[model samples]
Target: MLFASRPTCIKRLLVIEDDPLTAFDNEHTLKHSGYDVVATVDSGEAAVAVIASEQIDALVLDLGLAGHMSGREVARIARDRGIAVLLVTGQCPVDAEEMAVACLGKPHSAAALVSALKAVETMTCKNKTPRKVSGLTTFWRPEAA
Candidate 1:
């Protein structure tokens, strides 16, 4: 008798956005896209706290967080911890392409977010190396809706 292989576990995502509405929308979209959104927080401090305590697979960070620590800093920390990070920002920083696995512009679609996450996961799984903040980056721009 042949036994079927077990399915891979869903990825756990953390959404860090200052805007309540945007955070809610992002959480909803990620959930419907099959990702397990472990936490949604409004500040960089909160994000750091959650990251330290959870088994998070990825982070959806807003560049302009309302706190002392910018999202860029948080992403760097997360990457150091071997977690993947994707930036969702209105004004993409000059170094964003170098800091994250992928950078998506603000007002992006759910499909775009999902696609970026898949690409990050694929690259991470293939490399089997510790996540480096200075690694190659993938910038995805969703078509106008």
Candidate 2:
């Protein structure tokens, strides 16, 4: 089924998760969900580097990555650079009103992931939200800023 997105610009996404299985799942799901996942990295440092050097339009970021650099840090960098971010985690949610467009809790469905991303896309473009899904929380962010 078709999703809500700009017809011409397939969102260029990046996936950042430390868990091998989750990372693989995210990439596969996103690819099938009509998003162009440009890269998948497992650390904050690598995520930072990819966002800096590539044309990444969004990030599917998992907090609690095993590293000195935190997922929050990468989200901030992406946010500052006008890249959309959707933070995912099972632990305590971070204070991310400015740094991310949405927060998706763990143990979610592929449909939830797609719906959450579509919600973020619509919210960013139209300032309107879609139907809320379980485990998905959204926040307002300035257009690409």
Candidate 3:
């Protein structure tokens, strides 16, 4: 089990979604929700580039991206770099529990997004996993010792 403690409250976000409308919605929602949107990119390549250069706190990712690199790949890279992930997808991957702080399914509301992110903060910072949060599948990590 990994014991490293990353900052639980994510302030800066990188959004990776190919759909123009969804991307715009996510960017706008996150910004209005008081999260700094570092960049909104459609491809994992661009996401990776931003990850390399920016001090991003989290990645809001979509599964069906239009590029060679998949969302899973980007999530791995982000996690490796100590960035949290919040997956917003229609088809949640089987291994999402391993890669993301939470999986927020598609057709979700803004309230659900913010709530799930707050759950993330609770889990990571407080080491308390909340149960049955709406519109999200929160992940688990071993408590840091």
Best by lDDT: 3
lDDT score, residue 21, model 1?
94
lDDT of 1 by residue, 24-120 (tens): 9889978877778999998899999999999998898998887798888899999899787888888667988556777777777666666666666
Which residues of candidate 3, in runs, are more than 4 Å off?
Answer: 1-8, 142-145
Please name the candidate that would achieve the greatest TM-score relative to the true structure: 3
Scored against the true structure, residue 66 in model 3 reaches a CA lDDT of 83
Q: What would the TM-scores of all predictions be?
A: 0.79, 0.88, 0.88
Clashes of 1: 0
Ranking of predictions according to TM-score: 3, 2, 1
Model 2 weakest lDDT span, ten residues long: 1-10
Task: Evaluate all candidate structures by whole-model CA lDDT and list the values in order.
Answer: 0.75, 0.82, 0.83
Off by over 4 Å in 2: 1-10, 92-94, 141-145
Backbone clashes, candidate 2: 0
Worst 10 residues of 1 by lDDT: 1-10
Candidate closer to the true structure by lDDT (higher is better), 1 or 3: 3
Better of 1 and 2 by TM-score: 2
What is the per-residue lDDT of model 3 for residues 1-145, given as tens digits with 9 covering 90 to 100? 1212333467888999999999998888777777789999999999999999999988889978888999999999999998888899996789998889889998888767767776777776678876566778888775877
Query: In angstroms, what RMSD does candidate 3 have relative to the true structure?
Result: 6.1
Model 2 lDDT tens row, 1-145: 5454442332899999999999898889888777888998998998988987899888999987767899989999998987878888885375867678888999888888888888777777566665787888889744553
